[model samples]
Target chain A: MKVQISGLCKKYDGKPVLNIDNLTFEQGRIHVIIGPNGSGKSTLVNIISGLEKADHGTVAYGSNQKRFEEVRGSITLVMQHPYLFNTTVFSNIAYGLRCRGADKKQTELLVKEAAEKVNLSAFLTRKAATLSGGEMQRVALARALVLKPELLLLDEATANLDPESIGIIERVIRDFQTATGATVVFITHNIFQARRIAERVYLMMGGRIIEEGSKEKTFGNPESRITREFLRGELIF
Target chain B: MDNITNGFFGALELILSGNREVYGIIGLSLVVSFVSVIISMFFSVPLGIVIGMNRFPFRKAVIMIINTLMGLPPVIAGLVVYLLLSRSGPLGYLRMLHTPQAMVIAQVLLVSPIIIGVTLAGVKDRGNLIQKTAFTLGANRCQALWTIIKECRTSIGASLVAGYGRAISEVGAVMLVGGNIKGHTRVMTTAIVLETNMGNFDQAIAIGIVLLVLFFILNILLQKYQGA
Candidate 1:
């Protein structure tokens, strides 16, 4: 699904944290937003996924121009330090289906499918509270992926994962992208990861999108000075 | 020494023989406290959750009020209920004075604040994460509340158990409102009081034993639910 934002502004404690004049995110491609710490990348994604509100302007989703509440179920965001419900992994994965009133058979089938996709089939019956850190992140991924959200937002969801876990998650994410072809908004500080996964790139510094373009043009052949410095790891905010 | 020994043995006998008076008191105590806690929860649990989850004007003041009421003297509560149900009081026309209904009212008044206070603490401690998680997973407001309730089930159960303990072991409020009417309003705690006042220490000890057993079972159930 396509989303367009214009004249968006968000402030905290009477100071502007995000002040985007205009931005558009298109459908069916993995988009990566890269920035330094406190550069409002997470804030922007949160605004997109309707987790946090923008003080000014609007976020128009898809062709219908649906507001957040109207299409909230179709958008899923798995944040950094993801929280799993104090329940079995299977139940956690099935939660979205259950909330939508899916039947027992459908819930079981879909939950198992999602669990297998994340390679968590063996942990379905285990209590979510007992899982390790990386396993918890996988459960969170399974939970979000099970719903097959039309717009999936990942806000540094794998920031501290082990390399092996990160590799697994990246593979699963690739598999999902190929299968559903849904719009994926990825936020990360890892330039290597951005290079590997980004189909398009947006660079933000000081709460503004200084430059945005396709991956090759944005990262490989940088245009803006800030973008070039960021690519060289010298643009520390 | 002989009196205490005899009282213990007599209590065992009364319990083993299922003495009707003792059993009736035990039954009435359980019924009144159980019903009162159940009704109180319908109002208190939600109140606690709302107060805990949201930020509003005077929230700290409301929390202070609940905390103060948690330590409300049972006698003051009993006196207040007595005035309300007495002949010259506002609710006197209901003619519920000296009845089990009045006892239930007093117990509810005493128990609700305790439940609300404990439950509020539980919600404040762990409500937000589960709620945010549920919302991101596509749960609506009602569903989010249900998920928070499920996540905090252990603390909620403990809160209810605390209320139960306070209600069943209470003496002043139930005694004042119930007027200690035999075979009708007499509960375990009130009966213990009346029997001891009349120098019938054996039956008092016996009833106390039964009360202990009931408390033990209830706490066991609470612990199991908490651990689950």
Candidate 2:
């Protein structure tokens, strides 16, 4: 489903955190958002996923037809911090499906499938709280994926992973997107990883979208000085 | 010095011999404190979770009131319950005065706020992470609530210990309400009071020893749980 965010805005303590005029996410595409620290990338993901309410404007899905709450089950967000339940890995992946009342057999099938997708099948009985950072993120990812959401929102999903873990996560995400045709909105400060994964890129600065375009144009020949400085790892503001 | 030494050894012997009175006090104290803690849990866990997780009008006021109530004097709780159950009082028709039921009521009144207050603090401390994760996982309000409570299980365990500790050691409320009746409403604290007053120093020391041991064991459990 297409996601159209129009005039999305949020403020904390009277200071603006996110202000996007208009942005459209195409179905079945990987959209990456890149910016420096404190660029409101996570805030955007939170607003889009309904975890935080936008102060003004609206986020609609499917050709501006459905509001976020109207299409609630279709979007899933994997937060930057791996929020694991104090339970086994199997239960962590099965949590969302169980909340939706999935039967035992179906839950078992989905749990195994998600774990195998993330190569966590061997750790099903392990406590989620005991996993490493990368494993925790994978469990979070598996949880979101098992819901089969149409729109997957990721806030720095691979931010703290080691190189090997990052490669494994990228492979899993690619396979899941290929099989399910799920649209992905991933936020990261890593330009190199963005280049590797994103079909379209959005540059955010000072709580606003400064520039957006296809990866080649935005990365190779950016329009804004902020974008250029960000690519160069130089101070922008 | 002689009285202290004899009382101490006699108390130990009484416990070792499984003296009927000692067993009676132990059993009564356990039953009363356990019942009170169970009732406190039933009421306070849900109240704590609600107050910790939701935002509504007077939420802060309600929390403040509960916290204040946690520091309420045990004697005052006894007086309040006493007034409620006394003859010609509002609940006098039930005629529950000078009974174990009345003592349980006073203990519940004394400890429910403690349970609620401690559980509230625990829930507040852990509510943020659990609520955020649960909401992101598409959990509805009730599911999110249960998730928060489950996450604070260790804290809830601590609250139970604290409540039971307070209820079991309480002497004022049980003495006033249970009336220290021998073999009927008598608990350890009340029995010790009667024994001490009647110059039965051996029995008083025995009960005191038992109370000290119980408190020590509870403290050890609390420390272990906190470490865990």
Candidate 3:
């Protein structure tokens, strides 16, 4: 889905956090939103996914620009510290399908497929609570992937993950978009990861989009001074 | 020492021999307590989930009131129910006073707050996360709530057990409202009180033993359910 934001404004305790005038993430591409800690990347994705209401803004979805409620089920977000339900990994991965009332046979098929994609088929019967952090994250991702969301939002989804898990997640994300033709908004703190996966890059600072373009243009060519400094690792905070 | 020895043997005999009157008291106690706890669970569990999972006006006040009521004396709850059901009182038209129904009402009032408080405490920490997680996964409001209940089922079970304990061991409210009529509304606790008052120490000890054993068995069952 093509997501468009306009006149967006948000505040925390009367202190402005996000104030984006206009931003659009094109459909069927990996758009990496990179920013430092507390830059409101998560907040933006939360608003886009309908998990949070923006203080003053609008988020419209798809070609017809439907409201959030109309497109809610098609959007899914994987959080930074994903919460796996206290149950078997199979149940965790099957949760979204069950919510959509998928029959037992179909749910099992899809859940197994998603788990295999994330290399978690062996862990399906194990308790979710017993998994390591990386395994838990893969389970969370598998669960979201099974739903076949049109708009997939990952808010630092691979944060604190091991190298192997990160490689697996990035590959799975790339594969997911390619196979499903879905829009993937990947929020990350690591610029290198953005360079590796982002077809389009949006650099945010203090809740505002400082610069955005194709990865080659945004990273290699000229852009905002702040973006340059951020790329060079000199833009502290 | 002799009296204590006799009471122990007499209590075992009373239970094993299945004295009709003693069994009647035990049956009545279970019936009243089970009814009250079941009724209270229907109200308390949902209310607790709602309060624990949301933020609204006077939320702290509502929690404070529930907490206070959790510690509310059984006599006070009985007095309130008695006034409500008495002939001159508001609900007197139903003519439920001095009966098992009245005793059930009183126990419901006494037990509800305990269940609610415990359930609230159980769900408070993880309820929000569970609800939000389910919602993000495409669950409707009811579905999300069902997830919260499932996640916190252990705490909910503990609450039911706590409420059951309060209702079964309760004496003041049942005594005041049930009138302890022999073979009618009399339950184990009230019978024990009556027997002790009449200096039938052996009989009182027997009833006490029955109450303890019954509660212990029920507690084991509840614990097993929680573990499962």
Candidate 4:
């Protein structure tokens, strides 16, 4: 679903973490939000997913412009650190479906499909906590994907993954977006990765979106001087 | 040595022969403690999850209060329950004082804070990830809390075991409120107390043996549940 956020502000201990004036994400597009470390990219996506509340803001989702609670089940977020429930991979994948009271046959089928997508089918019976970092992340992705959320928010999901693992996750996510026409909000520090994955891009700094445009204009010929300096790695944000 | 051996045999015989008094005491003790723990769990588990996972004003102070209550002396707990149920007290019209129900209420008062305190400690280490994830994945508040409780099942189970230990071994509170009346509120602990006071050491030792055996069986069941 299309998401528009306006006047968003969040603070931690009186220090503002996110302060966005207005940002719009088109439905069925891959939107990458790039920022330096601690640039509030996660906070922005978290606010969209209602994982974190904005001190002052309005989040409009879809054509209806409904609140977060109204469109609650259609959004999902995967954090930087992999959070797999300390259970078998199968149960972790099935937890969402179970919580929503899905039937046995459907839950099994969806979990199986999701596992196949993330290539975690073989490890379904394995304890989730025993998996390696990359494997655990894959399990988390599978768990979220099984829910078939309309808006998937991934915050630095591939930050620490090996290139091979990153490639696998990216491939599955791209396939998912193409197949379901879901909105994918990806936050990353790598501009090249953004250029590779994003149809539209927003660059944030100091709790605000300093630059935003298509991939070519923002990454190749940005208007903002800070964006230019940030691209050149000459300025520390 | 003679008294010890004789007492041991007497205890064994009393248990083996299935005396009604011994059985009744065992049964009542189990019922009262179980009811109390169940009651405590219903309130404390949810309260603990809410407090441990949410940020609110004076949250630390509330946690401090719960922690302090976990260490509340048993007699003090009994005194509170006693006053609430006594004939001259506000709830005196209920006429529940000295009944098995009163014992359950007293034990619940003594152990609910322990349950909430330990559960809070357990959930405090979980760091809100489960609740956030669950909510994002289409879970309501109840479902999210259930997710947290399930994730920390081991810790919650340990908290329950601790509460049970406290409830079963209690004496001062139950005696004060339950009145330790013969054949009615006389549980294992109170039976042992009465037997000892009347200089019936053999019978007291017998009840003590029964209590130990009861503990072993119950703990085994608990371990099985935890393992499952």
- Which ten residues in a row are the worst by lDDT in model 3 chain B? B219-228
Give one digit per residue, the lDDT tens place, for model 2 in A1-237. Answer: 788889988999899998889989999988999888888988988888887899998888876579877778778888888679889999999999998899999999999999998889999999998899989999999999999988898899898788877888888878778888889998887888889988899999888999899999998999999888878875322
Lowest lDDT sum, 10 consecutive residues, model 1 chain A, at A228-237
For candidate 1, report its TM-score: 0.94
State in Å the error of residue A18, model 1. 2.2
lDDT of 2 by residue, B1-228 (tens): 888888889888998999997899889999999999998898899888778766789998998999898888888999989999999889999999999899999999999998898888888766877888887777888998888888888778888899999999999999888888888889998888888888878889999998999999999888876666
Worst 10 residues of 3 chain A by lDDT: A228-237
Q: Candidate 2 clashing pairs?
A: none
Point out the higher-scoring one by lDDT: 1 or 2.
1
Over A90-194, each residue of candidate 3 has an lDDT whose tens digit, in order, gives: 999999899899999999999999999999989999999999999999999999999999999999998888999999999999999999999999998887888
- What global local distance difference test value does model 1 have? 0.89
Candidate 4 lDDT, A73-171, residue by residue in tens: 888888888678888999999988998899999999999999998888899999998888888888889888898989999999988788877888889
Candidate 3 CAPRI level = medium
* Tens-digit per-residue lDDT, B77-171, candidate 3: 88998999999999999899889999999999999999999999989988988887898899999899889988999889889988999899989
Q: Which candidate is the best by lDDT?
A: 3
Query: Could you tell me every candidate's TM-score relative to the true structure?
Result: 0.94, 0.92, 0.96, 0.93
| lDDT agreement with native, every candidate | 0.89, 0.88, 0.91, 0.87
